[model samples]
Target: MIHKAGRASRAAFRQADDEAFGAQQNGSMSKSMPTAVEAITGQNWQSIFVPKVNCCEVAHADRAAVLVDGANYFSHLEATLRRARHSIFIVGWDFDGRIRLRADQPADISPPLGALLRGLVEDRPELHVYILVWSVSVIHGPSATAPALLGSPWQDHPRIHMKLDTRHPLYAAHHQKIVCIDGRVAFSGGIDLTVRRWDRNSHRADDGERVDLDGTIYPPVHDIQMIVDAEAAAVLCRMAAERWSDATGEKPSSTAGKNDDIWPRQLPVQFRDVSVAIARTSPAYGGRAEISEIGTLTLDMIAAARTSIYIEAQYMTAPAVGDALAARLREPDGPEIMVVMTHTSKGLIERFAMASNRDRLIRRLAKADGHDRLRVVYPVVPSPQGQTQVLVHAKLIIIDDTLLRVGSANLNNRSIALDTECDLAIEARNEADRAAIAEIRNRLLAEHLDCAEADMAETIATEGGLIAAVDRLNVKMRGLRPFSAMRSPGPTRPIFGTSIFDPVRPFRLSLPFVSRGRSGAWRAPEKEL
Candidate 1:
């Protein structure tokens, strides 16, 4: 039943896989990897964004911007929500109604997210708001889940509907973070509208405003959210509505006639008149075909990179991704790779499972980096207490100056094939678009290095590449630090070593002790340590 385009896409992927295999067997990628001459001459420049293979569709976006941190994303989200005249749909792994979208402002002026939504619905008769959060999040998420499970004043209104999404397989989470306003604009990325998530771009170690519901100050965290308008936004809006309908069995009213300009005036647009591709990762369930568009897109982008590949992720234990990066590293003239991740996972369970696997993958990648073109580090900021590592929660990737992707899917097995995820990607088609994408990458590197964007760009030019520039600029009190393998202690290691906590596919109670891997092999999941 596959169409011509699908067959062509499959053929392209098969060719890539065959080339990679040949390179591995030959111990050199001179025949497979693109040469510097070809890259510079712009010869055989085929985009990796193939619809039905790496993405759902490529839609036109009138305007788009990458919100670097939580501060920018939350502020813009609040503004856009207030301007929603017809419909507002939000989907997230976690959503705390008690958290203030704009904590910098007074409570009276900028109320909590729940209170703000309540007020908006009360003021506008035609306006309706729909929120969907993962069902299991009520148990594993923050304290705000109690209010959502029980009755709350904010969701008491009929116009404001909140539902817990239980449409996925057991142990599979709905991990997408998306917000669409009146079908005019949409926000999608890693930032969740929850507590302990908001922090300024400065990432001061001791920000007074970065606190939880109980007023406990949390460590600084960094995340990204990409905002898009026009047809792209409408596509996301439809996706969000479809998710709601699947979970709640009620299709929300369409926003056909409610075309209010909801783009936040304060937010700056990074790109205009661009093609935005929507990638997703959804587990197969209820007769639905599994979608691994994000995973496929990530591999294709890595393969297509000519100069550099920049990544910021919360976790780095996806086996296929590690193998792909390792293969690239073995290339004598491969693109330089820079990865920014958290110093350590937050909870004990995560630390035991994710950290061990992360170190193992890092060691593997390090071993394969024969030409030393890889740099894996975590960001830190100077506080009054001393230097503290900033919790990097952003899921972002930049392939040279050609492509930019931001989404909720972490570099983990669960995100690739098990959990539901969404990512927004844009490919540069012109010089202006390329410049904008490169500037955004520079801005992110500057934020991590605690240097000016212009300085980062200059350093990259002077040092020849991003890896060299990072090496030069990372000698500061607040900057990136390399990771080292650390042994996990205790017998709980073995319990968590299994993919029981982070399966690559849907969980079946009948086969509770086994899980299906990407290769369609049934094995007892165990993390290599």
Candidate 2:
């Protein structure tokens, strides 16, 4: 499934008898993690749901802007930098110059965003640019995944001296995406610019040659992104500066990527009047580990939505979070929930820590959906070998269109509690703002379902949520269905709630461990039920 650079083959996700994603990490079970209530009951989870940013004001909060996904956000960001009048700065878990912003063009010209900066520097002398990637371990397991052949092209770029962040706890990463142009617009989401991630709205699952990463076609990938202005975007820029300094041992200049003529070159796109918050999840360099802002924000968001919660993500594997969602859905008046993500099978990387947890994960979400308010799904690609392409790699959420969360975080244990994730949320406090958010959410759904936004809204209204609407559509048009998997029927043993209260997540001593396919190490993943 490397996509391009090789023949397309459909191989079943074989259950490796060996451990997945490297070596076994042995630590003191009793003292390593934090405590959690077995049940986030009526009152326990109530405090977290309140809107962090009150969006109820009637005046026009800045509308009409773009919010980019971290994965591919950098592509258009170069356009932002070329157009800046005041400043330019960035933050993320990993920043690779080998990734071309305009992959469709020549390498020397589009050698990632860094070279473009050098080129524009002569034309627009006022522009300044900065970048901050995570300080992951040379440990390699969950840290960096750069392509070997391309080499580090950004290293030599004049305007951009990329800094790798090392200011984090033992088990965490600096995972946030921010871009500010003249301090007017910003973007936040999960898509990254590495390899094998480029695709149009067609979402061709089997077509790997379309969205090429390194000039050669890769896979049928997809990403969710947005644009924003002033209010939220400004905060994101500040966050980037903090991280930039943390990595470089120097502060990001106020005029990092500032240019005058580039502003008019890029159109100022608008979405909705949504209030957003920018937060980080980095613990002290070591000592008592703690979940970052991203995790806290998710739990808080889950508790806030009154009607429904719809999410689009790349990966999914968090048990306490799954349990929290489940506990919420049990409420007679709890909001419905729909999770859309790629279905990573018992892959070599995921099997170690999550093998036993998969069934539990699926079953928990499934059982929650059984109540008619919650469901989990993944994008699919049609192929003769019966293989499915679950490549919805955008991390976003539309909560009743009243709240939108976009950033570099995934809905997994690693992202929630381990990685440094960042997101920008828009709170549609008024009727008009809510409508605009709804409009965009439906538009995105239309792209996925291959329909018009108007039609998608009607479907959402008809079925109550996209998950139900998709189910209803599959029932009627079985053949037109994209690749997908519905929530399974029941709970699996050793599931999130099956055991007594343990201060920390239950880690298995017997489960097999393995390193990532490219390396040789170990991590935790699900085993058998």
Candidate 3:
């Protein structure tokens, strides 16, 4: 199927490109600027940005809460799993049953993750759990271990159904990390149910708890997760069921029970009866249509911001998002943009693929900051020994006080086009909702700046904006550091990360396809994923 589609796509795009570029003097053209009111209202967000083929339904969560770090997310998720009654659904890019759920806490008197699930099924005759994981390639062996090689403990219980999804095209991954419990509560975010992902909010440089299966401590990592209940959870349940059917050609006959509310007892509820938008990204394969709602919503969020745009992610190299931000920076009354990222890319391949294009985007954004409204920074934690750069692996964005998004999708071309991802967003509908959203943003800044939330709020109130607040409180040693431009081969150099490794499109129509030649950026294909 992919081979036939690849050939048809290449032939069609070639003919279309020849005709489109021949009629135009310059191929690089910007989209029309939307009015401030129209942008803020999000009127065109559904009509213009999102592809019509996506079936992401709008739903409401009776209650919702935001979890800051791995400590909070893992602990609460464990509790929710314990409270499950009818069904438990988990979908992810990776899942290791051997990993401990709460490693920081005592050696869980219950059991390891795999054993715990088995025990749960053994105790409850009616409860069933379904787990779906990507069938990763052999090259990823160092990072991913085959469960079957380790005795396949997840298959010990008949009630526990486990499957590997190999339905996506080559080089594409099922990158979403989601768990739905009893059709009443759901969790979606970047932290996978695997090892080497446990850290407290303190982000201490030498914490002993950041360990893996071998008890080897790793670096400090930071991420976010969101918990939702009620209709929102039901919607996620349907999404998971669809994927299960697509992968195995059989749908499990389990449904979420409305009477069984699996909301964690300790987690505080932040909002009640709020609308939640579930966005997704999938590659075009088999007969399934591709969806790219995450990228479109990202562009819309940037366009609609009135005061500020706060972003924290592992990568910042998406050309469409960069263009929208650059357009905003060119405006005199545009909102202030502040981006928090990791100090450096992790491995050599990541440095070339991700950091190179990131350097280019930062330089380009700086050039467009005529009013000095753009600030790119990375956070560092102080220690008695030395400073350690905290790995900012959270995918989050806050636009003014009106919109908040947290999820598994990063601000990269792979997330936007070639990888399967999921994101949850909220749009404030009233003054109270806006204040709650603002508090979350302020709390995140407080965590990064190592100050009280009250203090951070006061600083923002007095300094007039988030950028000014960070600058006023940035005198301390353990705080955000400005991003310095590094020399690449050129402003538009095509590195492997930005080119071959993470192509902008999922189709294998060509070796390398350029979204914009002058900018040297890749965009998702109009006719492909």
Candidate 4:
């Protein structure tokens, strides 16, 4: 999460006491949305720059089961399937089973992930296990997936219908995190099973004791996951399936993977009392299917939140959405806003994606800052001895304990306007979840500041958010440099916390679309997990 306050002046974004600013949305929307916004805005909503769907009425649920994050590859997925007696369906940017699951499992018996998935298939032959992953390889790991010149076990699996999503643009990748079990449970958020995501709460600097079946230590990385059940998760599963059919020329699922209406489980089940809706930033669905769903969702959430908005993502470089948020903070009654994310710096490969277009988007929202209403911060696990940048990969956000979204989407153009991403949040008014989510946000902010979670929690409760809490503590981060060290020290440049939030814009974002070059994609031949 990079701070935009330093760049506030360059963009004419500043936050003074009791000053509020709002720009009416001027964009198109589905037939139903503008009517609703008229009730809120007291004017004819524009259907141009700001879409009308942004004001759609949201649904509140009763309760939901929790989804835990365990590097969410196959092993953890298998564990989820084993618990499901009803249904099983999957969607991903890609799903590979050549890896193991549990770090402490004995290796001699079978590769943890492959064997476990196999077990689920055999034990419950009646179960439907459908898997969908991205067709292209965008960012592959150092140890490439095992060469498939000879063929792999996944080719032989009978229950799995794994396919690549080709609906992506030539240079874009299908980036979504989704899992549906029996239509009763689902999980979405940023945690993926690719190599290097494994970590205990310890956030170890070194994988000294971590090992796969091959017995090697991978570097320590930090990430987050969103767990949910029933209505919330079901909605994501259905949307992912729709995308799979669009990408691979398959029909909508005969049974399990349709709109949430086909769900056997009734929604609005017990889960406190909050309005939760599913959001997406997929590429033109089929051909130019409108993307305002995600945009509307972000804006709606920002407006509804009366206390604060806490976002944690890998990339926080989306301008339009930033501008939306900036306007909200300018409101006299607007909520406190907190932005947290991985410190995104353009490496050689990432540089191509972080070009000027990216800068302009960031500048749009960054123009609104230095106000008491907005604060941005990033979390990093310090090296045991010194500060070595630990990439923060969690795509998370908590607004006033009233909203919590976790998934693979970053706040960027590609996510909201191009690539496919799945993110969900709990919009409950329940105290338990609200308290839990708020605590998690505070704990993460503490991680960035190198302070105890307990202390940060207190400060946040005192100041009402992680950013204000960090400021109140007056405890400069230990391993973390001031916001100036991450990028440029100048006020016009990105400060230490980058890609977290833009307080002046009219929207919020997922990470931007990842950029690619002519070297071509390194994907496994159409088979395998």
TM per candidate comes to 0.88, 0.72, 0.86, 0.70
Output candidate 4 Cα RMSD. Answer: 11.0
* Tens digits of per-residue lDDT for model 3, 237-321: 8888788888999887676764555788898898889988888988677766667667666766776678899999989876556
Number of clashes found in candidate 1: 0
Name the runs in model 3 displaced over 4 angstroms. 1-37, 40-55, 137-144, 148-151, 486-497, 509-529
lDDT-based ranking: 1, 3, 2, 4
lDDT of 1 at 149: 84
Which one is best on lDDT?
1
Q: State, as a TM-score between 0 and 1, how close model 1 is to the true structure.
A: 0.88
Better of 2 and 4 by TM-score: 2
- The per-prediction tally of clashing pairs is 0, 58, 1, 59
Tens digits of per-residue lDDT, candidate 2, 1-529, equal 0001001000100010001111012211111111121223453332222222211111222554433332334456666665665556656555554455665456665565555655655566555566666656224422235522233543454555566676664445565655556556666666544444545565554454354443454445567655666556555666677667756678655733333433324444445554555644444333434434555556556655677888777665554456556667777887877776655544554544454454556575565554677666555555566534645668887777666777777766556434566666666656776777787677666665666678788988987776677666543211123222343444343333212111122233335564343455565544211
> Model 4 shows how many backbone clashes?
59
lDDT of 4 by residue, 238-320 (tens): 66667666767776434343334322232222245444556566444334544435544554455456677777666765444
